[model samples]
Target: MPRIKTILMAGTALASVLVLTPSPAAAQSTTKPKAEEQQEAETSTAKADRETLLDTITISATMINEAVFDSLSATSYVGDKDLERIQANTPADIFKTTPGVGASMNGDDPATAINIRGLQQYGRVVVTLDGARQDYWRVGHGSGSFYIEPDLLKAVTVIRGPVSNAYGSGGIGGLVAFETKDAGDFLNADEQYAISEKIAYESNGEGFTTSTTAAIRPHQAFDIIGNVNWRDRDAYEDGHGDEVRWTGEEVTSGYGKATFRPAQGHEIKLGAIIQRYEDYVTGSSGSTSATLSRYDADTINNTYTAKYTYFDPDDRLLDYAFTAYHNKTKAEQTQVWPTSSIGNFRYYDVRTTGISGHNSSRFDWMGLAHTLTYGGDYYYLEGESSASHFGQGEAQAYGGFLQWMGHYSSWLELIAAIRYDGYHLDGETKGTTTTPPEDESLDGDQVSPRFTVGVTPFTGFQLFGGYSEGYRAPGLQDVFRGSGAHDTADGYIPNFGLKPEVAKSWEGGVNLKYDGILTESDILRGKFTGFYTKVYDYIETDFTITPRMTDNIGTARLQGVEAELIYDLGWGFINLTGALIDAELIDTDNPKYKGQPLENAPLDKFSATVGFRAFEDQLIFGGQYLAVGEVKRTQRSSGTNPGQVDGPAQYSDAFELVNLFANWIVSENLKIDLAVENLFDVAYTDPQSAWSYTSDVEQGKGRTFKIGVTTRFGG
Candidate 1:
């Protein structure tokens, strides 16, 4: 009876969505009659043509918004069109098309870990949603991970290195920032209200997704938007027709935001998001026990943010912003042990609160135009767990930064920045029969510096280079978390004296933007870059010791080259991306693991795609091919160490995959999308997934067909 009622309610909602929608003709007829319509149409088309030739603007690399072509560091932007083509359901799905990035999926929870330039875990990479930090970490057997529903994202931007120290601390690897949809994304210039609905399904997991959005502009000064989504999925089958356990999940999310413009040059935004996930996993965050316990888990994430901005074209000194945010994540698990005599329930929770203020000041000095940016921030993070064997702790960070951009001429630009970051940690341990009880505290601070120079040597060609230093402070999990102990004497131990990690990085790159190279309508945009990074006081567990313990493992280095190219032939587009990375532990205290390859680094990767637009830009089709090189396992420094350490590293072979997608706009009010992943049904494993302690290889998702439809009304 409950299932029946659910089905009935779903049917009613769908019916309401369709019935409330306005006709295509009504939506298009915004002005009275056909008067002035032709002029408006011509203006819109001209605006689009101009925008197509202009560079994309992004702010993830720095607090100030500027063109990507002008950026001093490597940056990638994912807009709405890219998300639609991939039929992205999770953050992992979207990142498959992005270069220099990888996602690790552990167990059933769809949220994946973000890896940039072969570095991840322990705050090395910072992930933010609408300027609020997504600092959820389980300290599990795999990488540190967080979850965010893709339906709420309007755009995603990535910075590949630590050139952006002004944003915050602990982003030595990079940063991924997600922007939520706003009222302007849906509402038409002349419309007062708008509604949009979307539905999607996938064949592999038999997943179904439904989402609805509403936007309203009640007055000239105020606007608001609201969104809700629901999804259900089952375990998916691999390429070999085998089911992957714990690969399914149920999710629901809600978001709402409002913007107010009280007066010219003043704006205020308030927003909130709530999401929940229900799934099953095998073990706790810090341990993968041999007992093979099954846990039914419920996870929740909630975030709220408020931002105020003041900007005026005539006032160069008042381009300023202030923001405050709070985020919370909770995970509850009910464990079912093989020995049914005992059952256990545990929970892990983390909360983060932060505030930031910044401003950009523009001035002219010595015949050069300059923009100076300065900012400061404070964040307080706390976490706790219910399990007796798990450790709990808290931390606080305060930081400030200053940056200066000098444009001597149209051909030469220079940038310099410095940041001071300080953090303090309070760690606690709950002792068991086999473990000791203790409480400890630690604190550290660092000053990071960066410099860059960009020059337009010739028309349509630009060259840039930079050097930077990144710093990451130890978090609670890295210092307090412990692996459970059994009857054996080799149980994991906690480390109270962990040191912070520091990275020195350098990069040189060339960007080319050429139009009319082949024909009047032809266009090409290309970027090629080479980067090297060395990390000091790298942190790793001392696996060679009995009952592994954390320690500073000396130094590690990664050097790589990345290339991207896109060409438009008036009717279609072709794109290519390639990367080659060498990562190793160059120096370490453990003699057994020195000069070994990193556990989850792929040496080489390449991908290519081609797409065409036809039928007056109403229909589009595209296909992509991806190839990855083999990854080597971490080896002991010497062969004389005791054998059989817990969760030894393993290697994976090279693999290739193919995908195809198509999109059609049936009418002004409706659109459809289709995608087929792993088109050849090839059996492969991703390096990120290979980190599972239980298996040497985790099978990647196989061939799957996805279809989606979107409808808009009352705009």
Candidate 2:
């Protein structure tokens, strides 16, 4: 295992160093050259675009806008061009090359759960779309899951670790924000109206997709955009030519937005999104046992948002934004198998309403530049389920935060922030044949703090370190929903004493940026981070005691190193990303469980991409290589359950994958894309998947080819 980690890190470093070495053309110039000379020598527009992207400003990390290359925390930004380059089909595809991030979903379902570092589930990782939070969960094999249409996204921003606690409460793990396309993204500078249509096909699942977008700028003060998409797919075969059951699905989604500028310094925007999914799933949705059930399922997700912002170029005292949003997710299922359970119907529904506002003030104080920001947010959530043991409750959470950023001269920077979070939960425990239902309630509050400092001793280089704290309140289900045979020997017991989880993290990293490093028209940029996090009062299920129920487990420790590097020359570019992590639970009462690797932890992985631009940067081609490490599960005896030892420890073998993608701009109004996924067609299963059973492993798709065409018309 140590050798593997060494190899992964060494390979990434070697590749980057080799790419940074000067070429024959660059070596011919012995003296320093002018910036204009370098710009004039650039022939590929893609190179310039890449440099600009590296400077893209992001607001997810510290709530203060700054470029990803300069942010003190680990941050990543994915723009529309990056999405198009990868030909993303699902949300997981968008982060395939990002370090310290993992996404898992069942082959038969479209819902996805994201993991950051070794933490997941129950608000650990905050996910939002257009400022509306997505907090839907069920007692299933996987953790909390969310549904979204990737085709509707214009950009995505991710901040890893609790350093982003100021973004919202319960984001002890991190934050993932998705921004949808607007009218300005579709309409041309001189056009009053525009329309775009796209069609795509995939060979593996025999999938088909059609999307249409229309935008209208009726006047200088107002604009609107609308989009609709439909997709369908059949079950695809695995690498071994075997059909994976219940993999087919049909989906329909729509998005619309309107923007108005009421005055010179005031703007208002409203947006809505809706998605529907239909599919067949086979499994015990609430259990991890091998026994399964079959069902026909239909799901719908909807979100609505309104935002107002006021910013005046002449006023340095105030920059304000206020937003309100609502989201709802509902899933209906009907049983199909087992004569006794036939005709049974189940449903799960969740609704969330929230409002948030913030303002920033900039000024010069005592020979230093300073920015002060303050914000507050509140959300109300309600969930109802037809199933006996599923979540059925209501929860409300709110928080207020203040942050300050200061700069001294050109080399020293400092940031400090603090937040107060509170939550209230209420629900009723299900009644059995011999017992009546009972109402339950719980409440908690806490305060967290963060501080950071950065130094630049030389040009194009920076060193930064920080310490941050985050808090996560217990979920409604964690305090309610106890059900069983009504006997202490065979049922679940509610633990009203369950405590919230708190995370304290320490991180240090370095940032590197250089223009004209190896060539007059070349650029190199990179970020490397090392983080250690200790979670107190970690929550988990305690099966060792009778009447199994959730409880606050012992402390957990997780540490990892992540690296991302990008090198772009005139004609081509290279990207490398990798992460190695170690995680374990400590001070557990159960001796057998102590020091064991977390079941939800992801394996070490590395990715590399190399691409070339031709025909005046109108055509692009690229290929990606991915390698994932193996995972081993240790065996443990099932306490109190005699004659039934827990299933043998399972081993998930390591795997390798290859992919190729290409895009062509045949004309200003037409574009084409082609790609091949799983190029090697190796039979393998992702180690991060939660659906794997002792006897069955969910296999990934086999070799597949995809093609897409898009056209635009405007007037």
Judging by lDDT against the true structure, name the best candidate.
2
Kindly report which residue pairs in candidate 1 clash with one another: 140-285, 491-547, 591-637, 592-636, 592-637, 592-638, 593-637
Write one digit per residue (lDDT tens) for candidate 1, span 1-715. 2332233344334333433343344345354446566754654564356345446677846688866656778877777777778777788777764667777665466556788887776578888888898888774445346779888888888888787667777989889888899898779899899898999999998989999999999897999999999999898777887776677899999899999999999999999999999987764321344566667879999999999999999999879999899999998888766577236778889899999899999999998999999999999999888754455788898899999889977899888899999999998654688977777798999999999998998776789999999999987777786665231265566787788999999999987666555443455676777899998988876666665566787788988877666766656887767677787887776666677776565336677789998887799898998777777676432223433332355667777789999999989799999999999988776766633434422367789999999999875
Off by over 4 Å in 1: 1-54, 284-291, 337-342, 388-390, 429-438, 485-490, 635-649, 691-698
Instruction: Give me candidate 1's TM-score against the actual structure.
Output: 0.89
Q: Which pairs clash in model 2? A: none
lDDT of 2 at 162: 91
Q: After superposition, how far is residue 572 of candidate 1 from its true place, in Å?
A: 0.5
TM-score, each model? 0.89, 0.94
Cα lDDT tens digits, model 2, 216-303, are: 9999799999999999999887787676667789999999999999899998999999999998766533233434667788999999
Q: What local lDDT score does residue 477 receive in model 2, on the 0 to 100 scale?
A: 66
How much lDDT does candidate 1 score?
Answer: 0.77
Candidate 1 residue 592 C-alpha distance from true site, Å? 1.3
